[model samples]
Target: MNAWSGRQAPSLEDFEEMALAALEGLPAPFRDLAREVTCVVADFAEDEVLEEMQMDSPFELMGLFVGIGMAHDGAAPVTGQMPNQVFLYRRPILDYWAENEDTLSDVITHVLIHEIGHHFGFSDDDMEAIEADAETEH
Candidate 1:
């Protein structure tokens, strides 16, 4: 049975509010980009995501990006190919925060920024630099 089968969870509105605050705490350009993005929370990773991402453990990943970046040809839609979205995995994120030294909000912000990096077609190196910059600014 799933761990969350009967547990109470924060409401969708509450989760969104928290995510928005996390995004708002990011650095300049990223903060601006995140304002135009939508964040969605899921209880766990989808079966397909587990298989495709080759996740041996359910708690390995905390979030995902599912839409085209602004660097892509056309605008990304919030649900379809045109909209951009960030998917937060609740169980995994919570597990990570509980296991690690980072704060929940910090972890959420990292995941949020990482996913948004995809939206802007940022390369891994680019993301590293951006993260470093954010860290210094913080």
Candidate 2:
């Protein structure tokens, strides 16, 4: 059994490393798309984002996708515009890990892919299909 070492939740830097590894594990095409998107690891969802999502608590949001999707904006931002960003709430992800059976790496990958789907303007079914393809590659 794993001993409890009284370690705190993963830090932002740790989350960043995990997110990078998750991205690298994805298929080439998907990873290419994700390359343009920045990944941010924060302790919790911002208040404004929570209100926008209608979430009652910070823990309710594991991650978020922000920016104009390729389907809507021709796959590139106009002058002076920001590119896509995926915000992974570290605290929420840690909380979820504690309650779920999946490994931390798997959970991070799931969240990253789901958020990237939003960046691509993909439906849930599309995301599922992409994930399926990724699994088959391994």
Best by TM-score: 2
Clashing pairs in 1: 69-119, 76-82, 76-83, 77-82, 77-83, 78-83
lDDT of 2 by residue, 25-135 (tens): 888898887788998889998899999989999999999988887878877678888878999988899999999998898788889889999888888998888777766
User: Candidate 2, after superposition: displacement of residue 104 in Å?
Assistant: 0.6
What are the lDDT scores of the predictions, listed in order?
Answer: 0.77, 0.86
Candidate 1 whole-model C-alpha lDDT, 0 to 1:
0.77
TM-score of predicted model 1?
0.74
Q: Once superposed on the true structure, which residue ranges of model 1 sit more than 4 Å away at CA?
A: 1-13, 74-82, 132-138
TM-score of each prediction = 0.74, 0.91
lDDT of 1 at 26: 74
> RMSD for each model, in Å, please?
5.7, 1.8
